[model samples]
Target chain A: MPSRISMRFVIDSSVMQAAGRAHPVDKRPKRCRGFLDVVYGCNHRVVVTDEIETEWRQHSSRVAVMWQRRMRTHRKIWRPPPDAIEPLTDAIAGVESNRREQKLMQEDLFLLEAALAADKIVTSLDKEVHGLFRNAAKEIPKLRRVIWVDLDEPDEDGAKWVSGGVSLDPERMLGSSHE
Target chain B: MASRSGRGNHDSKQQDAGVTRITVAGFKSIREEQSIDVAPLTILAGANSSGKSSMMQPLLLLKQTLEASYDPAPLLLDGPNVRFTKAGQFLSRSQKGEPGGEFRIAVQLGTNDRVEICLGKTPKAGFGVRRLTSTMFGNTYELTPEMDHDAVRGQLPLAAKLADGSFPEEVREQCVWRVRQDRCFLGVEATHGDGDHWATFSYLPAEALSHELRNLIHLPALRGNRGRDYPVTAVGESFLGGFDAYVASVIAQWQTEEAGGDLTCMNGDLELLGLTWKAVTRRVSDAHMEIQVARLPRSTVGGEDDLVNVADVGIGVSQVLPVLVALQVARPGQLVYIEQPEIHLHPRAQVALAKVFSRAAKRGVRVVVETHSSLLLLAVQALVAEGKLSPDLVKLHWFTRSETDGTTRIDTADLDEAGAFGEWPEDFGDVEWTAENAYLNAAEKALRRGMKDAK
Candidate 1:
């Protein structure tokens, strides 16, 4: 049998915030850390853009501040495994569209460029920004886009409902409540 | 191919006298004359089995000629040929039996000197013996006698000693007499004693000639399994040292101008990110060592710092550094062949590689690359279009297979400064996306609909 194709999901801060997870105290944002923990442990690789970190610092500063406060109480919270934080300067430098939009899009553009460059499925929860990413994906070979709902939803039918922005069956979105 | 037009702006003051041209004859499916000029940046493209690999054969052949130890058997023949009709299996065609099956290659090393190597198979003259003649320069040399022993070991010394002994004592003393001069005809008997006899004294100088040829670095294509076991660090070290010297020269020009605040600060920040001036070292063990960006301690958080052992860092940083290190370490007068440097890299990083190749070319390293990614191609095209690299310095060959012969044909496309080529084949951009095939499929569907409507 052919080897199964492996993929990576690079998450942005906006997607993390939408998941309602507490921000990570020392390193990446809370939702990002949770998403990374889940994805990294699985067969798939997970990556975060410097842009995502910068955005978390700007739009999600309160989360960062909260994490900073928590870190004071828990000194161990600030440390990350050496392999976890990969600086994407070279990957980021390769993106032409990102360079063109550096002034206007800032960190978000950097994250988008990283997603496109990574040649893996970019997982984001923001519907508004999907078009820009999808268009960029069209220009790049092997690049794709996936939403958080698609990732969390167990079945295609359940994913369809969540993707349509409906919460008719909360259990489907949340998984088994008995557990 | 039609004549191409365009004069790219000279980005660097360094002048390229021009690339050395290689001509191949009777190699594989390439029955006729084939030539490829190794420009600063040369791209070989063609459809499957179309002579893209054949064009590269000369390089391999040159390597085989220069490297005395490499076995040349597997490089000569393709797969077994068989013909099975309703009748049954029959002995198939032999590639060696084809018209002009004999192979010859002439490599222009420089303006003044060129080496032409030829190989031909002759029928078996006697029991357990086949005649093979290989000629170097204008001198006709036969290898049939030496093939029983070691042809390379036996013949190389004989050829060199013969050439050397032919030189007159006075010319030998001068040490710089041209071969064309009649005074340099040192007799073969003086070196080898007599015809067909291996002289004892001839052994030492032949060994020396073989050593010189062995020193030539034969770069292999990325796909081959043979060189895969070669340490990545060794390749990285060579590429990095060459790349660093080139980058230093390019940066020297920018130093004279007053640095703009935002740009300088941004560059400084990027330098802190460990994109520039990072050392790469390989441990005796399998571990790869590279300088990487890391968060400073709480007291020195804002201060710039570099952490060693890049492999311990994220995959993106570790994976991308190899290309930079390779480019940085490439030396002048060396051939750097890379296959798909864009693999696992972001588009931004792809653009960075383009600049890296451009900078390397300016410093005198010849780069030959094969890529499937358009983004990477576009980035290089952009550099060419912007006049950062000369149009003549870059040549792109598109390969397509001939339907009749199943042989690949290569066509050259010239990229203008705007990254636009004069003529793009219908199947050029994407192999999966074909307008002609799509239109034909649509027409077939419409015709079927008309037939159904009539029914």
Candidate 2:
């Protein structure tokens, strides 16, 4: 069947690297690749900022490059320029009082900027940063609507979410935690 | 059998005769020897001026030389396939301002048969063959010009075999080499062992090599534009070198023969491409005809006009018709090199062209495509993953030029079962991403400025 809906997504470089490291029996890499394949096959676009592309260049495998080529050919790789992350970085740092959590958000700030630039959806393999951003969403208005998904874990049901065309379920948004 | 000119042995299993690899050196951007392994579906891709055409031009040069009306002075510098009036025009130039010292071309047919030739400037005669080496019938031979250039000296290991009595004694003196006027021989008599008797046996391999080179079909990038009138040609006569000249005639021939088999197939492919029109040819006279397109009968509704001259419709249909005809009429074991088959096509139609190429390759025609369309490449990969085509049949060569030396190098990649290239060249097909980022940046700035005005 064709895709139900086309959504723009910002996938973390770690997930891309995992997808490139495919295995015959390992479900982790399979799910990683499967999520991406579903995302591509369903016509969803991938958002890549300069930071994300840099990470991809550093870590992604040949398979990921091939997938990226397909995405580019289909016009499904949505790359927004590097936004002024300083504003968002200051906002997150102000909201999250803990230094470690502030550092976590700093490292993954590009995801928020990229997602906010387009559809506000993200797929990542980083669990701690995913949780810290969700918790900080209460104080940060811009990060509230960001949808954080981890394909490596079952809590977010990454397989089911991606298989379902990545619909923006209210429960998956960071703002849902505050509500 | 398909009546299309240059098509022979329609069976896919007969693809054993397809050209396997081509090597070009000291020609244009290719200063070093660059080899591309030709597959059933070979794709040559790179940025503009990265030497993609240089790889294929060698074959075209050979084809035009063989097809010329008169004997060429070794190599035909100007011809229908590729045009160059002088040797220095095409010879690779160095940054230091000197021309390449040597120019060589080698083509491998099948697994074992190979032909490699070197060209040199012949004083007043543009360029001529300096040395010829061929491996045919499981034996290798080298031929070079004698001192005065009146005769060619051949080193045939088969001669040694003949002397050792491994073969029949009748073959000993049967080796003969003669130059015929009607045939485009290299214009030199070849002799082995300082004797005339050992000459005749060498001509078979050389003739077979020439036949293969002559059989190469090149459809240049620029095809004929849409026209109301197309000329009719003699029945079953082929337009081998003139790709556009053959479209109308081939369509006319197919419409009259084999129950319109090729015509029906072409219409089906056009429909699949969302073209909505069927190509129809009408003979206006014995020597002239017009090719037109009519809306598919099923697609017409509400008393709409069904027929229109091909020139009246969108140029995309006209531009793609020749490509469709070329692929449909080509037979297995035949090499059809098309440049930019996706030109003037929508992204969807360009993707559909991949299916056309895949089908042609599966049927045994060696399809060599030079394109800058990533959509076409993606479509071919999708076909492999869908099981419509095997990965083994596809070969991709990415041409990249050195920043410092300006010489071209090829990076070859293979497709796996999942349709992913085994090795993806760096920064290839990334233009879309760059454009996307640029557009997004502009959009974001516009949004921020609009917000400032609202405040």
Candidate 3:
């Protein structure tokens, strides 16, 4: 039998921002190479809608500020893949028909729609808009939900560390309240 | 009005305002009334889906109406389906509570004497009935709902009688040809009367109508490298003939430049033809199938034959050839609708394609191309600046979507003689790179410096 394929992670804006700040040498958020590793390691596809691109563009000035700060650190910022835009756009359109009640803006709806179409996980740290994706996942049969949350806490050795939720064992979450 | 000089050429004759103005309404994105003055050349500029295609509908409708028989389905497909109940219900209703769907095209034609052909809803029939009416020298005739069964029989005697009595017989005959939308009816009209009397209206032949319709070619945006053998159909024979000639010339030019000898043979092999050519060919054998290409000559010394397959050559060349072939094969006086002609082409090739359009336009072809390349637009402006095309002949419209209005507006620009214009849109080219990312980079650098000082 073929192994079951399931999307395993969702990376949000916070994770992207954290990844940008985490570079010890550079202050600029480079392309999320580490995050990309996580995506590849889990055998999952990442999706972005035109709306998400637009939102990121709106904060481009800030991104530039972060980028300049990191120039001396010789750090690189994450850049979206240009050629993959058309396929991503098509994916967004495919989901538009399925999500009728979600009065999401054309771009927002498209992102959710794209996630549904590609059967991929979404990574965004937006608590407010998590419901939109969750609703889409419920309505769309192939879609699954993933969320990114702050996992910075002290371990048994009294050392504070940051980790991904997908990486944390469920048994660990059950015993620890700090997470 | 006859010209004083008897020496008249085809170009000069055509320059005599065959089509004057076109008016469109309730068609696709054009919900409000809009009119375009048909000059020697008219450029339509708009962002994607901003009713630029709607402007072409009047011309398409005219072609359909004049031909003896035509299926309106293809033309209708270009527009939103008003009859689709689900979609229709979703659309906002007009003041009258009707389905708010409507479309009409009115055209003015002739020189020294003018005639107007209007097709759409009349006040009596609402918007469902398609009416064709003609007005000349202040007289009007209702030529639709086709008066009686005889009109449907296609005799058009009522049309002839109306034309002869109200207007000059010649004017009436011209009006008749202008109104008929299919070829067979025009043929019937030609045979029914004394052939000489109908000769003035002879310009409205089936062949001419077909040619005009075929000119409205829409090239798809998708790009592919492998050459698919498109058949030499009647619709594209003239264009194919032109393509063959163009390719032959390119091969000849390459041979002269490379071989330093007179060109005598026409062969498919680019190497023998002396052109910098790359191709992929597939061969079948018992062991396995193979694909390959001949290596490009290095300097003057030729030794080992370099071989590669079609896939080895860059996609840009193969993808671009199809478009060039399609354009070359297109008949003159037709509208070629190309979406982003600059895709996968180098800057040099993009400019070359722009020149091709200039040449095609000079040959009496009308081209409507959509492009995001400033270089292509600049090339067109150069043609206008050099007087190859009149300033009035070139029209540029810009499409801008306003968030406040929730609508797209197409604004026309005036390019001065030097091909320079005022105020390009802030977001014209890669706005994200120039405005947002540039600022982000600066901030990032500043933050990094602060961190260094703290360390």
Candidate 4:
């Protein structure tokens, strides 16, 4: 039998904060830690980026501290990759389309770029980034075949982060002809 | 066969001059006349079946034939234990070579001195030397009136026998003084004057004239990993063949005072594997000997200080023992060919093994190897760049399969003085750079998302 291929997630800092469950100090890292536990149990890896690493280095947030501790113990957290130059440029244009002539932000550009590179879900709670990525599947040829999994919408059980804002089927996202 | 008219006078390449160049045509794998200019240390490398062995096979074949048979008159294409088969085995069938080609070999000894032999096949018999052509280089000299007629008459009969394909008897004591003829045999008994730096221009058989040096000691990758008792013969050459043949006994006899004695050579190599040893070899009987190994005092293992059979310690020790012994025992100025000396060794020791060969070469022992380790290559290059060894002394041939023909093409990856290669390994660099770049991009994306959500 073929070995199970684990899915990789380009985990953002906001999700890490929710996973940290650090607010009242007496409670469990309440929000996204549950989602992480679910993904962790299902053999999903969280790809942490340099930006995420720097933030953790600067603040030593509870979630970041826990990840730092686990870094030595497991191969779960990894650095993220970017979408190719041509594909990334087209994805950016798609994100900035139908908007006022405002420049794309570096931080926002990284999320969309990394999602395409890792070919994984950009597990994010940001709705704007979700719209940007879900639309990128409409522009870039390589990314057109990959769906951006949105983690903002929780499942009815409130325990799992369900796919939101984009179709889960990759076949539906493919066939986007980029000029 | 080409005819040689010995109207010229020059110097014949001496034994001390070393083999300058060896050219082969219709030999195994080599389709045409390929001349390899020998160096102080020449290395032959190519992948398995890529003709690397074919190049070396010629030398080994000649060497083995000299020892395996009494008939030096015949260049036996196939011996009982030799590599190649009949002459047809070496006959080139490639596009560049003739379909049923004859085997021709030439060894360029000196400027104008060379011995070329051509071997052809008949209907019933296999391939053997059909003709011998040689020009022994000697200086200009006019025959004086005082020359001995009696000694000169003796060589004419030998030349007449050579004309009828008869062998020349060994010249017992001194080099022979000979008077030149239009065509004659070049033999040990066929030299001019007292033979003081002077060679006779005669058409002697290839074996009788050149006497190709058999100073080579080839030990095919050893397999004596069992560490069992091996029988040692008290006579002949001390070198053993096979993977691990008599290596234990060799170690017992060979351990030197330099590395603190008692398998010190073996232990020195083991140290590269993060292992130090207390080695002991005992003779069970007149014919039997066994070797045992243990962790040395103040050395590290997993905490048990017990002696165990070398076989039980691990295969790395077993696989490496012969290599260790060969490196230590090989004499100076001898050519040694080792296949996969880094076999079963860790990266640190593999890198260190490259040093062993480089150091061996520096000591005037020509070491040739076929390696599969990139780390070993990197280490050798680093040694060259640091001026530890000259770049000219090192040669790297990367064997790759050709798309045009299925045959292997050897591409020389030249190493500069700074140890930089002309061509980088494909899997070693670009793939790694791409992966690292991808990871960094993803990491940055994750951090950016966290920052936005916090704001």
Which regions of candidate 4 are displaced past 4 Å?
A1-179, B1-22, B37-43, B69-81, B96-99, B105-118, B122-125, B131-213, B221-227, B234-246, B255-266, B273-280, B295-306, B400-402, B405-414, B423-455
Worst-scoring 10-residue span by lDDT in model 1 chain B? B178-187
Which candidate order results from sorting by DockQ in descending order?
A: 2, 3, 4, 1
- Give one digit per residue, the lDDT tens place, for model 3 in B1-455: 11112212126444443444556665544555566654444555555666565566455444443332335421332321112213233222344544444455655543333333333344654333344444444444444444443452343444455335554655544443333443211221321245565332322212433454433455444544433222222332223211222332332233434542222211122332232244332324332223333456232345234665434555554445445544444443445555566787777767666665665455444456656776677677767767766554555656554444323355655555655443334223223224444454466677778889998
Question: Which portions of model 1 show Cα errors greater than 4 Å?
Answer: A1-179, B1-19, B25-31, B47-49, B61-101, B120-279, B282-322, B417-419, B424-455
Q: Any idea what lDDT model 3 has?
A: 0.42
* Candidate 2 residue pairs in backbone clash: B175-B198, B175-B199, B175-B200, B175-B201, B176-B199, B176-B200, B176-B201, B177-B199, B332-B364
Per TM-score, what order, best first? 2, 4, 3, 1
Query: B1-455, model 4: which lDDT tens digit per residue?
Result: 01112212111222124345567766665665666644434555544566666555666666656555356435644542255555666666765544555766666553545666565663434455444455443422122112344454342444434433322244322344443311211232344344365544343334432343354556554454554676654322323223255566666565533544435645665665554455666677887777667745235657345666676766766676666666555544445666667777778877877766665555545466766565676678668778887766666655544444434445555556766554422313223333433443455566667778888
Listed models, DockQ each: 0.01, 0.05, 0.03, 0.02
Against the true structure, what is every candidate's RMSD? 21.6, 13.1, 20.8, 16.2
Report the C-alpha lDDT of model 2 over A1-179, residue by residue, as the tens digit.
Answer: 22377788888988878765534334555566667667766677898777889988988865577678767545577666545333487777677458777887888888888888888888888888888888788888777888888776755567667777667777778888687
- lDDT by residue (B300-394, candidate 2, tens digit) is 65424567777787777777887788788776677888998888888888898899898888777789999999889888988988888888888
lDDT of 1 by residue, A1-179 (tens): 21123344455555445333322222222333344333322334444454555665655533333322222211212222445444444443344554444333333455545544443334554544444444433443322332223333223232233233323232322122222
For model 2 the TM-score comes to 0.68
Which of candidates 2 and 4 is the stronger one according to lDDT? 2
**B-chain TM-score, candidate 2:** 0.86
Worst 10 residues of 4 chain B by lDDT: B1-10
lDDT of 1 at B362: 65
Report the C-alpha displacement of residue B137, candidate 3, in angstroms: 9.3
Question: lDDT (0-100) at residue B134 of candidate 1?
Answer: 30
Best by lDDT: 2
lDDT of 3 at B439: 50
Share of native C-alpha contacts between chains A and B (below 8 angstroms) recovered by candidate 1 = 0.00
